[model samples]
Target: MDATIAALEELTPVSSSFAPIDDSAYIRFARTSPGTRTPVLIFNAIGVSSELFLPLSLSLVAAGHSVVLWEYGRVGDDGDTFFSRVQSYKALLGHLRAGLYDLGLEDCHAVTLCNGASVLARLQAELPFAVSRAALISPYFNLLHVPHQSPYETALVPLLMKAATDEGGAARFVHSVLNRGGHAVASKEALSKAHMASPRSIAGYSRMLRDYRRHDETDVLRRVKGELHAFYCLDDEAVSTDYLEAIRSAKPSIGLSTYAGGGHYGIVDNPSLLADVTAYLGGDR
Candidate 1:
């Protein structure tokens, strides 16, 4: 992980270089190989900050792909800010287009997970020319049945946010969320390393889940014209595999893959899942 830390630290200076076009948050992207021209755009899940995608992004970069990871301010904090939400999506789409243009990319592949899948689908429907293929990882289209901010969860968010902002709060929060719960997949050591790498980003993450709920993504998914890959975890506590299957059934052309054991955050803990994803993205069966 020392190499990852070095790469991230070297990237710190370039963090603020990608300015936002409007109210949307600007993203910090790291390319492993500057000379490689493979362009890939990533839209991250709402509940987590873009930093969470870094591990996978770096892996893709190592495979000779230039990756762009999008950040959407604080997720649930913008619940009441409708204009900001719209502008954020618009700005993100703009950023994707501009990045492709600057890279001289004719077509690009995009990947999104959870709530991001819906966002990317909507963008693709609006501008079909920009995206060539899409991959949705453990997508959450509806929140009604999915695990969401119950009264207890809602109350815990602010407290967690407060603690996450305090010194060593990130470590405390990750331990409480991932280790104490029977659902935790990552070891304390891994969580500790992640916390040290991106501390303050957790506050933004907690706020993203403040007013979180689920909604339908069928409409957006139907409009996406590119080759689609939908990957889901059967053990996911937040979303049901039935829903994912329904999406696959509804879209005959869309390809589906299921991982039986990984929980919602399996994508983080399972290297094989990333390998499968990389193969799919590379047009391998």
Candidate 2:
């Protein structure tokens, strides 16, 4: 683990406070501020908790902006008994926005990573009044293929689930995934630290992967009103860049940036990528 990330992990606090959206669901978010009037809401990847984005969220807070990171249904240590099984993505966004409003943040910008991008895009489409701008890192609107139940993933996930219940398991899973791409953008060391900080995050992430295959948003992208910025790594093995190009072409007005390499989780691995996203959200691009 990098010393800087380790130190930041130590300083960051875990958030448990939540607001009920319905009898079955609620939202949890983390807040940090540098006293900026304009707040930024970060929608994290499906399985990972909002804590995965803490390093970057803290940077945004330090830069004089308020940062809010939200955890989706079934993704955290919070109770999941009430989580809706209906797959209503729009309702999920509404729940999250209500939580943000409760925090006294009205107008806001947004940043989303991986599968979280589609949710953010859908939110902009459904509730244009709340969000002003968005930045998507390693965005994925669809999976390249429905992951078949390989004996490897099927057998491995259970073991991963067991180990991931503690700090050490989180560290191993993060290392294993990041290592697959040679740590070009997200170094194995950085991922290891993040895992130790939030061990059970993979369970949520795995659930996300399962749920995403059942949801599609081609219609929503064609209707978004907010300015959108998308970043993709050319070598990403997880999701195809063709989807990014399709989105860019669908909305020619939307700005797009592509990097040479960062595999699937590159956004977490590279701070420079976040810098680009921050600039776009700030209207510097």
lDDT per model, in order? 0.54, 0.57
- Model 2 per-residue lDDT tens digits across residues 32-137: 5334446787877654545456566666655666666655443423223222232334455667656655676567888888667777766664443477787877
Give me the runs in candidate 2 sitting further than 4 Å from their true place: 1-16, 20-26, 73-91, 125-129, 143-212
**How high is each candidate's TM-score?**
0.63, 0.66
- Best model number under lDDT: 2
lDDT of 1 at 227: 84
lDDT per residue, candidate 1, 195-280, as tens digits? 22233444434433433332355665577677888777777655566666666655778777878776665667667777777667
Off by over 4 Å in 1: 1-16, 21-37, 73-106, 126-129, 143-215
Highest TM-score scorer: 2
